[model samples]
Target: MDEQLHILTGSYALNALEGDERASFEQHALASEQTREEVRGLSAAAAMLAYGVEPVRPPQRVKDNVMAAIRNTRQVPAEAVVTDGAAGAAQRGHDGGVRPGAGADLRLGTGEGSGPEHGSAAGAGAGTDELGARRGRRSAGSGGSGRARPGGSRPGAVRALAAAAGVLLLAGAGLTGWALGQSTENNRLEQELAQAEQTQGAMLGILTSEDAKVATARMADGAVVSVAYAPSLNQGAVTAHGLPELPAGKTYELWLQHDDVMVPAGLMSGASAGSPMMALLEGQLSGATAVGITVEPAGGSPAPTTEPIMVQEL
Candidate 1:
């Protein structure tokens, strides 16, 4: 936990942390005034460096319209351009997107097969031709159509569209991340819940079984090892009380003896003088007639490397 606290300083200034992580960092920061001030100063510096953009003066009213559009705003009826059947049909077609020949005049740069982008002057001429064709059609048709000329959208409208696109992209990324996090959390909780249910059911079966047998042994440290075994279920519940906490990278492990061989049963750690720990030995005692507990390295040894501190005969 202390190591995790030390690592939070790197991300504290970015405002990028998710829930629980942010709260934990905040608590650590509050506890250490120096840490709090350091984070604050770093946050201010990061803000400036990340946003040291040069000033850009966009067209008048671009800010207002772009913000309003991003907020899903509505303007007065008088300000809206009315659209009837033909205009609506055009909108639906655009909404449906890129019908083969109706897409944008996209030009590829060099390296495209059999082609490179034309010079700026040629490109300008092409734009002019496209715009002129659009104007000619609008003039020839009924005035009820609200279609604008090619590239004729207002500067404010263009800004609004760009802002909308950016908002949508960010929103999509956020939703995808949230969904992945939810899936991971759900899987973790399900595993924990299943383990808890399994342990509880195994304990209940041992306690209620009519053919259950119990044995106990006294350790050199004065701790007691107890085992409740059920022959019918081939399972046992083991408990140790008054265990002394071992040094770092050391733990206690249990084993079940089948004839001359002793197989791993489970591992126990962290229990102290007053606290007790329980473990379930499912099917480990199926063909075994006795159990043993021994000291081993952390994560438990593959097989016991020392004599048993406690042993119980069935």
Candidate 2:
């Protein structure tokens, strides 16, 4: 048997192995009967450790918080699962399984008690046949009936049950925490999605409004430009459709011409087919008669350096 395989056996019993390691372990167990028996023995010992553990009482508000969170998360109402609080306490011989004030009379075995020797002795007549007899003797040693002993089967069984219950409670607490985290994340994402949808609707409404229209123009260089106008804002956005990219240090600048005075709009570094660029007007353009574009310096110049590369009558 590979040593790594044996190490995984413990993790497997605890349900900790994941992905390929877990799959490989399952395959190995399926092929090896000896390994399967070892897995069973290890599982039983693990169970004993899990059950013989002293109950850990979470905070007083933990249970209430968990239940409250569950209620908030579930969309539908259902019957509540009843917990036998009193019986659970009686069986564990405590007021609360894990409360600070709860009395714990159970003696938990550790070390060798958790070994495979103790768990896999098998049947009634083995070298450890005296183990059950020892339990009986210890029960007799206690000042009660031959039934109430520390290491007896009944006490061990009860401890196991209590341990299992404690494990379940802890597991539930973990699940609740994870669920709350996921709920918070989901709520955040939903809020973001809703905001995005609202923004998209508003943008769509703006795009289709009567004040907005598409305009097309041809440049002297044989490039075509398409622009979307927002008359209410006295602004228009343009994109060069199939315009050749300018060399480095060259840029496209926008202009608005009213009367004969040309006003600088804005500068763009590059243009791509159908890619929109914002063209912010320098001043009120309600009376503007024409829009034009010129190739200018990187940051743009106060006046045109050359004849208009593209011009469109509004």
State TM-scores per candidate.
0.38, 0.33
Clashing pairs in 2: none
What local lDDT does model 1 show for residue 307? 92
lDDT scores for all predictions?
A: 0.45, 0.42
For each of the candidates, give the backbone clash count.
Answer: 0, 0
Worst 10 residues of 1 by lDDT: 120-129
Q: Against the true structure, whose TM-score is highest?
A: 1
User: Residue-wise lDDT of candidate 2 within 1-314, one digit each (tens)?
Assistant: 55667567667655566434543453343334355445544555555566577898999898887665443231100101012121133334442443331212211122334433333211111011122232112222323333222232222112222222221221111111111232344444434333322222222212222344556666667765755444532344444544666777787888888889778876753313333333333444567778888888788888888888777877
Misplaced by over 4 Å in model 1 are 1-194, 270-274
lDDT tens per residue, model 1, 104-190:
111111123522211111111111112222111223233423334233333222221121111111111111111233224444443
* Whole-structure CA lDDT of model 1: 0.45
Clashes of 2: 0
* Candidate achieving the largest lDDT: 1
